[model samples]
Target: MPVHNMHERVLSMGSEEAGALLDSLSAGTADRLWPYDNWPPMEFDRPLSAGAKGGHGPVRYTVAAYVPGVWIRFTFTGPRGFHGFHEYAVLPVDEERTVLRHTLSMRVSGLARLSWPLAYRWMHDALLEDSLDLAERPARQARWSPYVRLLRALVTRVH
Candidate 1:
């Protein structure tokens, strides 16, 4: 099955400021975008750039393309059946507004076709929302669904 999953947040900040958030991805304690506190951290063999290899938890990918403070794309390379890429892009809406978007485009085969819609989809959605919340800095935090909570508990037990 083909999957085109996307999540985006319109932030009330300049493009440069929003771009800075993208640049901070996987930057250890300085990372302000990825929701590492509640989820698996995005790690790579080296600093984030083209050819860096890593992914959160069971997922794995390599940085296929990168444009500092603008856009980055990762091509999947693991867990079998995940074939395609996911990317983050910074789109300026205006001088005072910007759109931070994460897109997952892929085709799932074998067990992934089942695991994806059943489990990974829920967890992925929640994680992306959490990431966006970190970027938006909303006064009220985003809440994960009950299914997501249960899934997290189950995965934690296994790991």
Candidate 2:
């Protein structure tokens, strides 16, 4: 199994604002940015910190590491085929400019090879773009194409 990675970044934010966005990745606040509002929101058994355990919907993971207002990584634990981590990071480019980056890197096995490309990849891209749009405020929403919408519809049914 080879690693499948997706990276999306949004610009023009302050580090504090970006960091706050990263901090908000927990159970209560994630829906405000991510497309979680339309799906099962990200959640955890405890506070957003290392050792916490949770994930969205049937995709389970653990809080592998976290740094308040900076970064947090989650290592996948379920769906039986994902192996790797996803992380949110805030990078300061200047006093008034920051970048919020989300990265998911994993090597899949078994059904994931087909499912990741045929299904999850599309939804993940749309959802990440929507999330970055939320982070990039004052900017328009990411244009969701009909294909993305169709994929969303299909995945929504599976959940």
Identify the candidate with maximal TM-score: 1
Which lDDT tens digits does candidate 1 get at residues 53-145?
999999999999999889999999987999999999999999999999999999999999999999999999999999999998662486999
TM-score, each model? 0.97, 0.89
> Which pairs of residues clash in candidate 1, taking residues 3 or more apart in a chain or in different chains?
none
User: What local distance difference test score does each model get?
Assistant: 0.93, 0.79
Clashes counted in candidate 2 amount to: 0
Q: What does candidate 2's lDDT look like per residue over 1-159, in tens digits?
A: 776565666577788988887777754644445656555688889988899999887789999999988888999998789999888888899988887878898999999989888877777777778788777777456677788788878866876
State residue 91's C-alpha deviation in candidate 1, in Å. Answer: 0.1
